[model samples]
Each structure stands twice: as structure tokens, then as C-alpha cells.
Target: MDCEKQTTEYKSLLKIRTGDKGFKDLSVTCVALANAQGGRIFIGYDDKKKAPLPEQHVTPDEVNEAVTKLRSLCFNVGLVASEICTDDTGSQYFIVSVSPSMHSVATTSDGRIYIRVADKCEPVRSEDLQRLGEEKGAYQWELVRTKYLLDGVALDALRQLANDIRKSSRVRQHVKQMDDVELAENYHLVDEGYLTNLGVLWLGTAKQRSSICYPATVQYIVYDVLERKVRKEEWHDNRLNPKELLLDIEQKAVELTYSYEFPNGLFRKQIRHYHPKLVRELLVNALAHKSYTISSDIMIKVFSDRLEISNPGGLPLGITKDNILHAKHRRNPNMIELLSALEMMEGEGSGYDLIYELNAMEAKNPPMIESSYNEVTVIQNAEIIDTELLPLLDFVLQNYQLTQKAFTAFGIIAREKKVFSTRLSAILQLQEEDRLRSYTDKLLKDNIIGRNGAKKGTQFFVNPQLIKNAKVNLKTTLKTVEPYVLRTLIMEDLRAHPKSKISEIGGRLPEIDLQELRKMIYSMVDVELITEGARTDRRYALK
Candidate 1:
């Protein structure tokens, strides 16, 4: 059984068959799981011990009895599928599968609502209903019509938007033919003589936004190497709508951003320390998906070597850092539609995809995305790791059409020079080998990439001929250089950790294979650069 999460829960018993409690305890959990995201419940399992209790086999009737009374005990949830199964050691456990409630909320027979949060089932508080309902598709905060009429919105902003959309190449030509009124309605910005919450965001004035407590603010601060602030600019003027705010931020970022140039052929190739498209898309995503209910400004911090952008509302419900690239969950549908029409995204629900694609194009490290309960922060390192990759990726773009994910995979291989198959899936945040292959197989087949070894020891690298064609200046072979570089990194890591296991080293460098990493450590041991611990507690340390 998987560990308890937002979707899975484990229990020691199927039912509390004593007195008047009936199956209330198990039923409450079922309702809670169904209310949030459909999840599984495993009974007769000892979660702490990580084992199944054999005594559970003696109570087969209890499992069937609980399933019989499930519907009457849980409300607004579908009929749960359950089963009694035998484990390898002949231990029996009951399992109940609950689907997410079709309704916004799932309740118990007593009419109290509950929701699954992380690993625990908590009673739903009144304020949490909106958040849960929106996630469940029952409500959209962006569509709620405001008390203000269309006339109440800032007319100046509306005119600017009309002219902007009229000239926008991204929006459909026929759709752009509509006048301001029709365009506003089509974009879900207005209702019958009234402005929707989204309308208030884009067309309203500072006063209107203040009334709703809608925060349309951004803080751009520059920091020195020592983390001391050198410059700061803030925009809290709600009079500036989403578009104007985006443009303002983009303008300032462009002025302050650092760009590097590389010598190529007879000319020079210039790359921004941070790509403009990346900054624009990151801001757009932060604005589009940010929780408008929370009155907080998006903060952008420009460090000496990287950029950090954090927005309120970590991620939309059901979206996590591990699955952000693959999962699509829009917190603000109206805002999303407007941004998509504005051509900020590569396609619908592909902002993160575009970020990954852009990051790869520069052959930089994969941008870091993390979320807490209250905030989502994206960190983009500004340093360009590989300069020769610029013209080569252009070659691929001209010769082939790869998906955003494929481009990202190609960039990883291009930068790393050589990567083992065992490390690819974890680095890509993809759990399946075939899924990883989907993004990389075409590169191999087209001879854009080279593969060596097989299975666990299988290695992938960018085709050397491709580099030669791109006119890359090679001092040493690309494939031969990475191991020596990785050895230096390993020694640095062990020097800091002193006595560290292979897992500890791998945790710091997830791109390296454990077996290959072990061999590298042993190689260092042979050179008296490292010391190894005993067999039972095998660890590596600096000599």
C-alpha cells in the first residue's frame, strides 16, 4: 500500500461495530476523502508497523457489513467500491475505494461535511468551502459578478485593452472584430450591464480593487552577492490592470536583466541571464493562478546569480510541484482565458511547460518550483551552463518539431553530456520509463542523440556530430569530461557531509546514478582521496 497522502488513508479497522457509533469513524474518513480528491482506504493495516495484521482474516463478515451500510452513512458521494484481499503472508485486509464527490461537498448522514487534507480527514470549516468548491468545479471565483456595472470600471483601461486586443496577432481575427462591449462579454469580463470579478481585475480602478481587496501588486527587488538589497520597485496601483502590470514588470525586468554573449562562427550569440519569455510566462502564471481571495502581492527578487518569484496560494488544489508539469488545474478560469488569448502561454494550460522549454533552450538547469500551503516560489538560475547549446537547439527547432517536454529532455542531455537511464526518470519527475522515452526516443531515432550501454547502465548524450555541425569548439571530448567533473562534485559533497551514504550523496545530486556514484566514490578511495566505512554501515568520507 502507498503511504497516506491527499488521496490515500489507512486504518486499523473496517468498522467500529460496538454500541451506537456504528461505522461512523470509517464513514467519516470515506466522506472526507471523497470530498477532496477520490482516494483509497486500506483497513486492517498497521501503518506504523508497515505490515498487515493477520487477525483481520477472522472478520470477513465485518468488511461486507460495512460496505452494505456505506451509502446510508455517506452522503453526496458515489457508491464506494470495496474488496477483501489476501496478502502474501495469508493476511486479509479490507479496502474501500471512494471517488471524488460529484457535488462540491461530501457529507455524512449527520449532515456534517469533511475533507481530506494531506493525510488527515478534517471537518470542513465554513471559509474552506469556497476553496474546496472551486477545486471540485462547483464554483469559479473569477466569474462571480461584482456589484459594479460595466460603466463603473475604468473607461481608460477598457479603451487601452480594446486597442491592444484589436492589434493582437494572437487573438482570432474574427473574434477581434467584435467591439469593446462584445469583446468584454466574450472574454468573461462582463455580464448583463455588470463587471465580473475578472472584469474588476482587468478593467477596474484602484478604488474598485480596494473594495474587493483584490491585490494587484508586485515587488521587484535586486540583491547583491551578500544578499543586501541594492534596488527596489513596487507596483500596488490597482489602477494598473493585469495587462498594464505585466507590461510594467516586463519593462523593468528587461532594463535590469543581465545578458551574456558568446562567440560563434563569425558572429556573436547573445542570451539573457534570464529569458524574457520565461519572466513573462512566470508572471502571467502567477497572476492567472494566484488566489485572488488572499490579499498578497507577488514578490520577485533578483539575486546576483538568479531570480526568485513567489505568488500567493501555493498551487491550485490537486496540483503539486512533483506533478506541476503534467497536471492541469486552473484556479482562475476567467484570468486564464484572458492570458491565453493574450498569447502568454504556449498553449492552454502550458505556462509551466513553456518555462521548462525556455529553460532548456538556454541549456540551464531545470528551473526549481516549490510550493508551501500559502505560497509558490519559482527560482531560475541566471548562469548559462553551456554556451555551445544555443545554435544547436536552433538547429533542432528548424529541423524538427518537438513537444515542450521533449525539448526539455534534449536540453538536459545536452547540458549533462551523458546521463544514465536510471537517473533520467527521477530528474525528469517522470515515474514511468515509457513516459520518459516518449520525450527522448525521437531524439535517439533521429540520430539527434546517441545511446550507449543498455538498461540500468544505459547512457544518453547529445549526438557529437550535431555539436560539430553547430561549430562547437571542443577542447576535450564532451562524454569523457563529465565523470571528472562529477568526481570533483562528489568530493566536495563528502567533504561537507564527512561520513555520508550513497543515498545522501545522490540526494544532493539527483542526476547521478547510485551505482555509478558508488563506483566514483570507490575510485576516489583507491586514490586515498576518500575513506570508506564498514560493510554494514557503508559510507564514504574525505580522507
Candidate 2:
């Protein structure tokens, strides 16, 4: 029986017999599926033909044996669901479903761990295994008990926290009624008479916290026009507490604004460079998720165009750069709990959703979270959102529930007025046209955008009706072709040729100045839109 040629979904297998090879193969596939979104593995069916194979039927006894062997091989794997079905021709088949694991990485008998990438199982590297261990909270430093006793906890910090909790609308009535010790205990900040690391970090005196949790402090820096640090500050003392630390950071943060007066002089509009709520949310997350075990301090760097906050530890277990918006895990659960109770943060795992929503509404680029083995850095761009299309963007976000990729794609179109499929694909970091087409299709289907030209020449633009409904003058809003529009033209040329020399590309786009073409090509290469070839070749291609 032929297996499915493509690795899109379900795995196909022949009849499972009484053999080690079959069991081993089944075990490996199970690990792969479990590491990813769970999928079905069919025994005694041909996935390529989408039919039951008469010769591939497995007996009831063999199915039971297979399940036993698979479970034994993948003992560490969480849930393995199985079922048997009979076709019209009385051909029986077994279907094993492997559910994704939340904590442990699944391993086969030989001790090799695997994760599903595309349609194949790839071995999990040592680095990835370490990261997986982190995601699972296998080493939660914040949960560890410290030598410091509860008596060392600051009374003033406790009183301030309780007061804030009482005033917060998010806190429950019972929580508001609880005393400091009761509240701390409820959140697992105390173990016996000793305060956990969380308690020390939250309530210890400035000198006590600095001595005990030295690395848990934050370092703030502001860079000048030349990128040299012009100012620096530290928050090692515990006198401020976490709540006051947030307040202090806000006070130190620079808030700049741009204003425009209406033609009639009746009103004015002002836009702030950064949002205070966003700053607070970022600071809270850093404090709540940093690895207290690490010796490095959390750092917040402010530049002219962006705000970057880096925590000592990487993303919490179960969260990846790609899945952070949809995934939630707590590296410092106790800290998160107390902060949430005090209404310092939104504990519903919707923090990123709101960040993205605010970015969309403002027409600003969404904040980017990058992770390494030792740290997670978040960069929030300060570019003002384009005011012309703000209404259209806000309308779409309010009315439609779109995927992150789709939302980003919409933003690109809104900002550029029109964008080529290739440029859009490049900007979205999507390698496949088919995958990008799915998102573009949604925009087209909803009539939020319209496609101009076709195939490689395809340009996505906001639907005129959408702009009209948004109450913008169509004539004033009409997109004018810019010099950067030539970038799309060049991308289209590369799509057909794959690789081309400057002269050849120049011949294709003769309207563009030779020097301008060179500048655009070099700029594209710098941004990784195009790859440079050898000196002899001196060619460019889409990457």
C-alpha cells in the first residue's frame, strides 16, 4: 500500500505485525505527532489512495499488541488514544491518535526525541531539548525556597500591595478581604515560615533584596543619536517594591508627542510616541517572567525609534516566538499571581492580544518578542501609525477576527496602499506562495482588499468601498506610485528570472535610474529580500 506522498497531515502505515521494527516505527511517529499538533496514524489503509487495503487488515489481537508495544516505547508521552474500524468490505484498521505533550518531550526506546517539522520527524537538538525543559517548568527558579525567612519580608511593601489590591477593580472581594500573610500564602509566596524567592523579590527590603536576589534587579538605559549610552540607571534596591518599580520606570521613561492643528483651527490631534499602559505591561511581564536563577539583570533599553526590554530568562515553557500570542505559561507563577491580584497585569493570557490590538488600532507595527536560550527581548517600535488609514485599520480589527499573519498582511497593504505578492511574502517571512495565498484570499473574500493585475504582477490594495465606508475621500486617499514601487517591479522581475544581473534587471526596468536601481538592490540585499551572488555572477534573486 502506498503511503501519502505529501507530509501535510495523517501518517499512513501498513498492518502492524508482531515485530520490533513496526513497533519502533510506530513509536517514532507517535513522538513526532505528539510534539506537534496531534494527528492520526492509520494501520491497514492506503492514504495515497484514500481507501482501505484488503491485504493490510490487522487482526484484533495484533491491534492490541501494537498498542501495548507503542505505549511501552512512548511511556513518557502523555495520552495515546486508539480506535479500530471496519470498512464495507470488512477490512479492519487501527487508528492511533497521539495528543501533544505539555511538559515532557517524547522519546522512543533508543532515547531519540523527535518533533514534527513540515511532514517529517526531525530529531530534537540538545538546545531545543533544554528549551523544551524550560517550557515545561522543569527548572522553575522562582518556585524554589530561599534561605530568607518571612520575618525578612518588608511590612511596608506588604501594606502597599494590599492597599493596591483593595483598590483594584480586578481583585475579587475575598482577595480584598484577605490580610497580607493570607494573600501571600494564597499565592504560594510563603512556604512554612520562610519566604520563597518570589516573596524576597517582591517584599524584601532594598538592601535585603539586592543582597539575596542581586540579579533580579532591572537596568534601564537610554541611547543617544549615535547609539552610545547617554544615561543609565539601576533598580536593585527593594524599597520601591514591584508596583513602585513600575511607577518609577514610567516616571523615568521619555514620553514624546506629535501634534497637528486642524485647517479651521477648531481642534488639534496629538499622538504620543509610546503608550504608558504598554510600558507598564512590558515591565510587569519582564519582572514576572525573568529567571531569578540567572545572574544577569533585566535590561530596558530606549532608543530614538524603539523600546527594548530584555529579561534574563528566555520565554516560559510552552511559549515560542511564533506561538506566543496563543500560548501561555508562567515561569514565575507566584509573582504573576500577586501582580494579577493587585491588578498590575491582565492574567487571562490575553495580554499579547491587547498589545496587538492596540498596535493595529494605532497603525503601529506590533511589538516583536525575540527569544534565545538565556533571554527574551521585546522591541516595541515608536513609529507613529499612519493617520490616513487609522480608521480603516481600526474598523477591520473591531469587526473581524483575523489571524496574526492576516492582520500583519492587512497592515502592510494599508501602509503601502498597494503591495506585490512577493514583497508581501517577503515582509511576512512566508516561504510559500500557497500559504500566503490563504491569507490574501481571506482579505479578498471579505472585500476588505482588492487584487490588481494577476499572478506575479498581483498587487493588493484596500478596497475603495472600504475606504469610502471608513469616511475617507477616495481621491485624496488614492495611492500614488513612489520610487519604492520600483522595488515591487524588481521583485516581479526576479520571480520570473529567479536570478538576474543588474544590467539584465535594469534592461527589464529601464524607466528606473541605474544608480537608483543599484541603491534599491543593495538595500534589498541588506534587508535580506535579495541575496548577493559571487563577484563573477553579481546576480540577485528572491530569498
Q: Highest TM-score: give the candidate number.
A: 1
> What's each prediction's clash count?
0, 2
Candidate 1's TM-score reads: 0.75
TM-score of each: 0.75, 0.59
Give me the runs in candidate 2 sitting further than 4 Å from their true place. 1-102, 105-135, 213-215, 255-267, 385-387, 391-413, 416-461, 469-543
List the candidate 1 regions with Cα displacement exceeding 4 Å. Answer: 1-103, 115-121, 213-215, 228-230, 254-256, 260-270, 385-405, 420-423, 426-432, 452-458, 467-512, 516-543
In terms of lDDT, the best-performing candidate is: 1
Clashes of 2: 2
Candidate 2 lDDT by residue in tens digits, 425-453 = 76555566777786677888889888865
lDDT of each: 0.76, 0.70
Query: Residue 89 in model 2: shift from native, Å?
Result: 40
TM-score of 2: 0.59
